[model samples]
Target: MQRPNYPSGKDLLSADAVSRFDLDDIMERAERHLREEEMEKAGHALPEPPAPRRRPKVIATLFDQRSTRTRLGFQAAAARLGHQSIDAYDTDRNRIGQTTGESIEDHIHTVELYSDLLVVRSHMEDLPYRVGRLSYLPVINAGNGADEHPSQALVDIFAIRQMRGPIETLGIALSSDTRARFAISFVKMLKLSPPKRFTLCCLPDAPLNPAMREAMTVLANLGTAIGIVHDIRQTLDHDVLSIQMQDMSKFAHAALGNEAVDKEKESEPFTLTARKILDARSDTLILNPLPRFSELDTSCDSLPNAGYFRQVQLSVPMRMAILERMLLGIPWTGQADSFPPSSGG
Candidate 1:
């Protein structure tokens, strides 16, 4: 199979921001990167990584909201790729001469003048979209409001594909809060690499029903089964389970007003007990994106199948692939066609 076609204008603002190339394009590259590291660790000599044909002076990571993993991961990725990552932010919401009441378009233009690529995280819903529109440089969205976190989705799919042989037909459970930005972004990526069955089991008040019901049609066209449920136990049969922290918007006011809200037991609905996991298929993979809150219990962490830490470990290479794809160039193993044909009704 030919290497995937990357677009001429190299900006990735969302999961489908560029063309939906084979999802294997991302995963296979990450797999090779990981293997190269493991080989080097075992005292095997390897060829040096190629320097970029056109390297950037700095990758500006602009954050309108705070982040730890996204910020630090990109920096580590940049360093590995032979580039510097700069943390760029505006505390007063004033860039492009915000003191002069400058427009966002002009601000983006000004931003492009200084940086090679813009990795942005915004409190606003579509700030990265507008920025990518105006700036000639690459605009890689770190996260955008409640809608998407494209890089997180990239790292996530990479982790899952590595753990399992092929992402094609795995039954994946999206448990806990279905409305979290991480879950939404991940599901969007799944459109390109549809699993055999996707089960979204959330709380009683989850708003994922209407939109996800529609996505089921699209996923079905790509040969994946889909189901939505409020009962978390229904996910016990899945090959992979990701438990997300519940949404806390409604309870924020109570906590701010000094009203104690007891939410620990409320989290029991989605917690993955050892019994639930052990009784499933022996190879079942447990996934979580952490700062876990109460959704993922501590007991699950030491389980051999727990993939969250390895998931975080893979983000370095995942982000490296993301940045290098858009900015510099990285090598791929060329295994897109080798993936098994997706199996499901």
Candidate 2:
């Protein structure tokens, strides 16, 4: 974990880039960190955690927008991984680039001179890519317009794989605004290891944004049984929850058969209550890219099938894994293992 050695001109600005990195190796290191803490509580001899060296790395963050989970999460993760997180913006939302009328390319270049990596959350979706195009340093897209939030997608996937099983064995369904950036990013990451089943739970003829639709096509080509459900009732159907129920098979395909959907529903576009979920395959996991107004009722918070809330708890560890991979290079694996050579190269 000395000043690490890695390929020059690499960056992490999109779901495709995140998919290429050794996510599995990164995650293993996080689990190692947690295990060390558990062992300490048991009054047992603590075995050496994965990386022994403790060289510190610096991460520069540039946010044109405000965020609670992502901004604080990156900073916390940097400390956990023995790194630094420096904000490129001030408390008043003042950015050097904005104050000086500098181009994003130049802004990225300036930060690369000081930090090991850059985390950008911009109002424009393409801005992260623009920065990556100019800077050789690794760039993480914290929240990029409405196009995607790749890191959030990473945390959700990691949590799901842990509770259920592998990606190939889960019948995953995402609800709420399918066209939102969170939804788009989450679905794209899921496509990296297309699951046994995926359903977009939305209203009738809900507009499928081109970005999301393309991702669905990719999963379909990869052999995942993808479905689009308009009604809350259809979500619990046998076909959608058929292939992957290894963890909840005892409930079988009875997700919502016994219960009735709320006759008096919320004034939201989509709603999933505990009753509907319980009557369906008890194993079908419900996910929502949050900031929810009413799309997801509060009633489901206590249910066993909810995975969205865990994403918040996992934001730090997932971001910590990214810092360790990009900076310390602790769990070094070949780029080809997860990261393919960039097409532009």
Candidate 3:
């Protein structure tokens, strides 16, 4: 076929048309609309329930990484929306490690034939984006590498917004090995005028992983005040903290380059002590992505301002929105057509 005469190169907006259209930006706007709809659903409008859309679909939950709450949240969200969820085991279950290298694109294509949406948690960061581009169905990034956990980030942001209202100015204290991974998700959440500050509290010897360093640079350019501190004492200045502490005893020899007196002595307190810091801020929000060891004191849970439990609760509604978007292709915009005519309500 002969190509028609095209507009002159000078008339083109830019060399990269894809740059003009960002998938993440679109998804972020959609998320905001859904959140508002959820709020309306929970408000005084609750006496008349909104008619649920009938979109029968199947969601594939592919996990190559360890997950507890994430798996359950996605499953529950799918069920609530009357969708089927298929749990796919690791690639090792198939012959990927054998004769033919099962490429991500191939694996996604095969799964897309069976399911309407793909929710994947992989050990490699690039895998999700690769599959999203190749797959016909919507691809949700559950957790990727030590990189982004978009769902977790969304839920966390929802929790913060619920507790503190809009996050035009906010503070977050993130600690430990997974900081960089969570950082990617958190930075996107900072689109609400960007966080006033983000403090990293790590052990003096523990350096942030490479991915985290890159995330910090990116966030800094976006007007977020990023700081790395070796002590939690510095974090007391911040109002909210989402903490993750790690035991470095295993890598102590290599990373620390120190032959400690005793292994027993190495078992120092990894948990945050709140008794002293509690007085620092009148209304402090403490969050630990659970399964915490000594990183967070249990007694602090009883405090009046403790919002960690609230964070976990917010995950349900957030996940519901995500499943609706990815599996059922529900529009996130709160436009009139997004929901059926509401006489039933």
Please give the RMSD to the true structure for each candidate, in Å.
Answer: 8.2, 9.6, 10.9
- Per-residue lDDT over 242-264 for candidate 1, one digit per residue giving the tens place of the 0 to 100 score: 77766744332232223455664
lDDT of 2 by residue, 1-345 (tens): 133343443566666664434566656766665565468768977665446447567889887666678888899988867678898755354544465576555566667778888898876657777766566567777876666677877777767765566777777776555556666777777766778888876656557779888988998998988888766657664322211111111111112224432323343325566777777645466555454444567787897767666656666777787776776533323321243234441
Whole-model lDDT, model 1:
0.69
Query: Could you tell me every candidate's TM-score relative to the true structure?
Result: 0.81, 0.76, 0.70
Better structure of 1 and 2 per lDDT: 1
Residue-by-residue lDDT tens digits, candidate 3, 65-133: 667788887887777666778986564465444566665546666787788777877765566656555
Candidate 2 residue pairs in clash (backbone atoms < 3 Å):
20-338, 20-339, 254-279, 254-280, 255-279, 255-280, 255-281, 256-279, 256-280
Model 1 RMSD in angstroms: 8.2
Q: List per-prediction Cα lDDT, in the order shown.
A: 0.69, 0.64, 0.59
lDDT: worst 10-residue window of model 1: 331-340
Which regions in candidate 2 have their CA more than 4 angstroms from the true location? 1-9, 18-21, 40-45, 49-55, 91-106, 237-269, 279-283, 329-345
Residue 61, model 3: lDDT of: 84
TM-score of 3: 0.70
Each model's total of backbone clashes: 0, 9, 2
Ranking according to lDDT, highest score first:
1, 2, 3
- Which one wins on lDDT? 1
Kindly report which residue stretches of model 3 are placed more than 4 angstroms away from their true locations once superposed: 1-55, 90-107, 178-180, 218-222, 247-270, 279-282, 327-345
